[model samples]
Target chain A: MSHVNGLPKKSPDMNGNVTITDCGDSALVAKAVGLDAEAAWRLVHALADALDAVRLTGGHDVVPTYDALLVEFDCTSTDHATVRSVLAHEAARLGPHPEPITPPRHFVVPVVYGGEYGPDLPEVAAQLGLSEGEVVELHSGSDLTVRCLGAPAGAPMTDGPPFPKPVPRLASPRTRVDPGSVAAAGRQAVICPMPSPGGWPLLGRTPVRILDLHSDPITAYQPGDTFRFRPITPQQWDEYADLSLADLVDSAGLANSADLVDHHG
Target chain B: MADTLTIRTAGIVTVQDLGRVGRSRYGLPANGAADQHSARVANVLCGNDERAPLLEITALDFACVPSSDILIAVTGAPADVTVEGGVRPQWEPVPVRAGETVKVSGIRQGLRVYLAVLGSFEADRLQGSCAPDTILGFGPALSTGDELVLRTACPPLDHPFSRIPLFRLKAPVPPFPTSWTIDVTDGPDRAEFGDTGRRLFDAPFTVTPRSNHIGLRLQGEVPRRVTKGEVLSRGVPIGAVEVPAGDELLVLHRGRGVTAGYPVLAVVTATGLSALGQVRPGQTISFRHRTLDQAVAAHRAQRNAIDALRSRVRTAFDALRIRAPAGT
Candidate 1:
């Protein structure tokens, strides 16, 4: 492993450490090794900010995941060696250990739990040896941080405090999980942005449209954003479901009134 | 009003360009033509921009009738093109007169074919690209009787065959080996597989029928992993060769999902990726290890060759007094 400036290079197996590796001729993957949910969030955000600082230097893309960031560059314009050296220089500038200074953006996402919207709620409760109401309380109670945006367009994979017992994946994946279905597997929680085949246990369905093609930013949730599910009735879901992109932008606290006009127009 | 081309027999036809870049961060897949090399060649042959919208036809049995004169070229899979019962060769520009029906059939040796027209196709653009994302329902797929509107009008040529000599330049076609051997470099998770990773190049693997634009699933000997645990889901590149729990090898293609959970043992080179695009089901393929420097060199060489072909096409057009369609 190459050292980042004067900082000591940590091995891949070391916990809470960051390591960089060559993915191919055009990309490099910098992974935060063995980090928990909170640490992963910090590292991902820090790495994303650092990569953004050097955005103009021919880095085509910077994708932040659960605990890693993949930086892709055009080999014709900028070679791998230049990208590596730039990243190293940035790492050194940020110092050996960088802290997340920006406060995480927060949101109160409304969800309708159980019934037709979530068929696997009762089964998930039974598996965890808890009442149906208890499952809902535990699921919606904790603050979840968006660890990554993936699996599909605008899909947010969030991580929260672990439940008393780990939630297991379904034996057979469903043919299609409805869009906005909130599901949990093991300790990870994810909101299905679009209808897709999924294996996770459904806990509820959110009314917020996470992905809107017409929207300027497209995705509502970014990495490091925190959200907690607020239980709403099925009637409320119907009301919010009819909300337009402008209304969603208002409710999600995405932009100010001035920017809303531009997005709406 | 712009002239339109109506599809008579459509078989999995969709519009594709160079794809939406810098959008993967939003979990969007970088969807484009499956065989980019062939697509570029087709565009060059018809004198369109390299990233112009074109049709990517799979298992092609496609026929289209133009309302007016148009310049068209078909590349990849070596298909037979006929314009009004007259044979037209592949990899060369062919001009069809008004109300002429062009039929393409007998696609052999490969799976997909790229058809490029003179001007850009008037299609819906999502994120500044015409490439269809089948999973996301972003663009329209061609069907029988559907008219493909052209952005620019093509007036009838007094002598359509006059420019045939100008397009006689030989296009450099990439070799599609009968028994394919793809070149790959080490992936991020190579260390996790240890000796099993080295064994990936030892035997040939068969492409399974389950493969599609998403990925090329291959049946091969499962590589043993020294570590057994889930790595955090991360961004996966286009040519990543991921090995999931089932021991099957999946080479992610142009329409690959933005992220994957499987351990990636290797990544196919850019040239190897275009070659992978031509591989049909049931075909056997083997992997050959290549260094990063070598992969870079090979990619540069392929780009240089394409550049050379572009210049030759330009020279021919200039000499023949045939102006390429504007904004190409």
Candidate 2:
């Protein structure tokens, strides 16, 4: 990458595996830039700024999308072909992606399996021909990556250890899933943040409320943060009923209090 | 400080400005005037900035007494407005005498109305905005018998009667046929839908009764998700149309979720957004796709017209010879 006015210039190598995606009307997104979420994030912000400059100079209304910079032009003011040319030119000269930023903390979520909390536990266990305990062992043993946040703030989007048959959700979704329920959809896993309608196969519940709306940092997990799950008994889940979901996630053991150290704290 | 308005009956009123902007990142929806265009015009008529805080009255029956005489304007949804039992226009300025009661009663057509006072009103700003989001329980919605003190300068003119410039245009009614067109853009998940789903977007879809601030439950061709790529939850602004379960579309409005999990089908343009804003339950809506360039132009053009009309009103008001009484 070369520098123009001390700013990093976009290089041809940026095209490989790093494809730009459009999020909304005003956003352009650079995705799949390896696992460096921060690098892609910086590039997105810079491209947004560059596109904003172009809009201002051209007297157009352009906005940055979630992943892509949406370039809006006034048809009455300028031709579409001309605007496309300018976008192409900017995309070519834009700076390379920035260095990745590591998350401040990693969280290990512990979930209780079977019984009332996980209604689908028997079905999943029977399908796999494994005891409920073995299923929980497999689930809690794997390292789950933090894909992204969802509905409730800081709620994790996890690639699952794959349950048998990936049980189809309820014909009709439950009006409200109890917060802390560990749910599975297809091959993915999700920790419910608040009481919301969901159709996922719930394995068990955790005690953590990962999303704190009132707090300065709304969510605990950002992209690139690592997560692991551990199995806790339904009795253990009830023991720490009053404790938060953040407090129950453990790297090891049913309730390793030391592992529950608050990262924000 | 100017004299305040004594809310003899608050009647579901809340203080509003042009909802809190630049705070969407914090997961807070900007809960401002429901009818923003009407609110802007009302503020401009009273020589206040368009962003000034005002009383947004829902379903009327709100009455207030000005502590000191001052100028005020009301807009949005037709309501029977009067000061001391005298009738006044729904969308213009009127003078109120100090200690005299001003009342707005019965929503005739619209759902929400804006009441603006000169030099703004006395309100506690939360999260850099006086607008209240009832969903979050941040600010209190005005109830009956609530008194509001105005933190404004200058009492009413000695004469106490000011002629407000009248530029009357009837607010657009919904279920518009033939001429009414709502502009939408290609959705992020547009390609995910089959021909039938695509045709539904190309055709008109009826807005179902299940629509609200949360989202619009549309009755249209169901969109099929062919490829099952995991859609990451991300920020979805007002006017995003998503198809989650089937062919029916869920269109988001002003009080939309800051983030969503569904694949977006279309993003409505500003003009299309205006129609969506006024859409009540059971209204039929059709999507007209426009190029991104056209959407931006339409927004700018609409603003220009509104601004021009405001200037004309200001000029007419300035031309009128309403002089203050001689001071001793």
Candidate 3:
């Protein structure tokens, strides 16, 4: 109930811009209405900064998705009112524009293209009216930044590379997609770190284990991290099966890592 | 001393603790015991810390054999716990000699059973938690013949009052009800459904057998559903009542993903999570609407009550010179 920028605290219903609503008793979601996903993403960072300034930080507790930010806290300690107040106060404090939260790290995962590594690769190439090699050229050709980490546990979802057209998903999702299966749907490409059900079209598979319980650095990539795929042969894929994310990043060489992008579109 | 417990039979078994908190940003769900209160009760009765590693056995036959003398507590869905072929009580500590076979089966009234050993239970850890995340293939699932090593064996039970376990003297167990009417709060997308989402509380929804720790899929009147690819992907909560574009209404549990794309119309309150976790498949569940403030108050009350029970148990253990770390 302390003063926030000399304004009396507003209830959950009074937030001007952000639609701050209760996700549950323990979590709150502030989604920016009438804003594009990018603008919403910026608002998420602003709210995160606003929360951090007030000593509310649990690095992993604040989940910033494509547009909205879901903030979770212990209901026993931090009540719902305080969280909403902070969001409204910060929104009022910083009017108009907020800076983007760009991911600072980059990783190039070695993947085996086509065949069993990704069953949809051939069809993806055929549907796009491009040759198989051209498909690989288009798929592994761009540096895609992660939109967010979601669902299948640490699978990084990113905007798809410049395929001639927005790639289509399967008519019905497969019951299971093998772990390390790299998939594409519409304009997004993602890596399925575990065997789970999915409808995305598979382009290839990465031998580099992105997320593992027993390994150090369980999940190396975060939102905004630059994620790129480097096509490797089936043998190279086999070699990468046991390697960790650290191993791939280290071997890819940090200096030349920035040169991996071609902007094929 | 590296003593181990061998899993004799595994039926949907895993190891869990309080769960990995604040790790959702890394795309990890705070996967833990489906029923948090029962897990803590089991650990408290066994003279171990609430966050100590323990076994989470779902509805199915589960048995284990200890390699050393240890005290264990079995709590959750009422179950027949047999130590060395003899029945042992649930919700209190029971001692088992080295090489004794402990069996937990016929789990009735609930879905999960917690088995907490008296000392430090060891397992491969991630983010300082031993809880398994099956969706991510994160922790080892308990398999028959899998040996679970205990870093600290049970303390010598030769104290003057060792004739009777001191920790067993005080264990406050709350009611475990078969009929459930869980409390839920309006979610961010509740306005999207408006009148349609009211069907969630219209009647009792049957928990379909398709349910698991990932989510409790209920077969009921489907509200105006949001197609799978409709909403932007966002982080979902432990007890989120997600409305998918399907015949079933899904209520997410602890084992759910950190982020999902389905639109959530309402979220079950924390006060209702334990009951949601313990209900058996095919059981009817109804939702009661509560304001966010009321929901928070109920959570604090439940937590405060658990803290009181923990302190009392710790005091009794101290009388026997037994160490029970303060519950956080």
Candidate 4:
């Protein structure tokens, strides 16, 4: 992923109960700092609690900033002034962020690159002036972490190394992208959970159904969960195709190869 | 028995009360009526709690046979209602005889209709909600031959509105005017767009065929980049209007993906969100900008109106002296 310059600190003159930062467009962002994860959680929970206490009816939302919590309330039930007031007070009460959100955990999403599974693999490789296998190596060899799930909830954003040349998104999104299609846009790697229209450059696909709406936990990634990638050949994909859902579940264990490095198990 | 509205034909219907709460952590969409205001109004007319269980009908006919005579109200888009093949009224509460068939024709204007039985339907509430998010396999949509059980006996009206007979008097909920002129407020990422993007707020866009509960894909001048770089994908509220491809405007709705990567320009006000629900593919839409104060005022006004209606119903019910039917 292209490294962000990091959050620009608010200028002294702009300080207020809620100093708005010009993030872009006509809208402005309200920024606050939490000392640690607990503090962050408290800031998040307090605002949520207040929103709930007001009986504002809407779904709860979450995002991936370590030091901050993102809240969206029904504009009809509450205004930005009140919401900002509640959040800033809550954040100030909690303090600043701790170092241990630990830069998210890494995961190696095993993918079968090229052929029919990856419609854009050849195109991306050609653009990079590298062979398809080289493209796979470049992608799978790098370290990655779950940033946030976008578009589809549970669709994880994992960082990848810089492309040999930038791969642009499809000019026109396919009406339905196959589930498990490994796609890249900018420096982010995404695994499609369900068939959806997407612009990312498709590289390969995984056999794993990573998202289960009915699953108790729902999403596998936490803010700190890490991610890595491993390449599987198309033949391996074919072999797994005959397997039942149970067989696929069994295969997840076997897919863990000796090449895997464990910073933490 | 309480009041049972038997299904003759279920019409794309579902048993919805207030939606499941405290469950977004599990990735559940707060599935309920797209227009919560109308749903609450229907409930109030039927002498039920504002968020009581009701039938959410989508684009088709729904016929129900009431088990016990009770008051009922229909709200949302105006639809042709017939009882025993005779036209019925909208808005004001009316009594239906036991076993009488109530039929609502396919939406002539709006997409959904709310049917509140005097007493709500009884279902095992999952996480304090009867509204089902089918993605989670919570339950199936209401279909023909599905028997719904009402939990309490109907409270008899000493003088039912059926006399003044609010029948045939349909409250015309103005149909979504001209392809839905949705109101929006600037969001955190609105700054990501370039100056040209600011000009986009001045015009209207047409809804593309790709639009759905997930999002409204609008065809227009995609906003220019403000960040000149990428921003991390993050949590977005329903009705968050994002322009991802940099050409088309994507206005998220109730069923939008739980998260998103694209830059969001603004979020639509809650009062306008129901209008989004009625927006069909190929419809035209315009963006109206409002300050945060305007949004908050609109929100509070809607909430206050809903709460006011609720209290008024309570007062009316309290004065009626309707006894609990039989064995408690």
DockQ of 2: 0.18
Model number with the top lDDT: 3
Model 1 steric clash pairs: none
By DockQ, the candidates rank as 3, 1, 4, 2
In candidate 3, position B111 carries an lDDT of 86
Residue lDDT tens for model 2, B245-303 = 75567877666646565667777775666556555555566778787667767766766
lDDT of 4 at B38: 74
Look at candidate 3 and tell me the lDDT of residue A172: 72
Q: Report the TM-score of chain B alone for all candidates.
A: 0.94, 0.81, 0.90, 0.86
Q: What share of the true interface contacts does each candidate keep?
A: 0.57, 0.10, 0.76, 0.24
Top-TM-score structure, candidate number: 1
Provide DockQ values for all models, in the order shown.
Answer: 0.52, 0.18, 0.59, 0.22
Per-residue lDDT value at A96 in model 3: 41
Query: What would the per-residue lDDT of candidate 3 be over residues A120-199, giving only the tens digit for each residue?
Result: 98889888999989988877887787777787787888877888777876877787999889988776789998898787
Candidate 1's error at B87, in angstroms?
1.7
How do the residues A43-139 of candidate 4 rate in per-residue lDDT, one tens digit apiece?
Answer: 3434444444544333244333322234544444334444444444443444443223233333546688877888898888887898988888888
Of candidates 3 and 1, the better by TM-score: 1
Task: Write candidate 1's Cα lDDT for A1-265 as tens digits.
Answer: 2323343323222222566777876777777656555565556557767777657355676778877778876665666766665565664465435665544455677889999988999999899899889988988897676777777665788874357877877877786889889998866788888777677888899887767787656775576666678789998887788653223322444443234323222
Residue B146, candidate 3: alpha-carbon lDDT: 92
lDDT of each: 0.76, 0.60, 0.77, 0.61
Task: Name every residue pair that clashes in candidate 3.
Answer: A160-A187
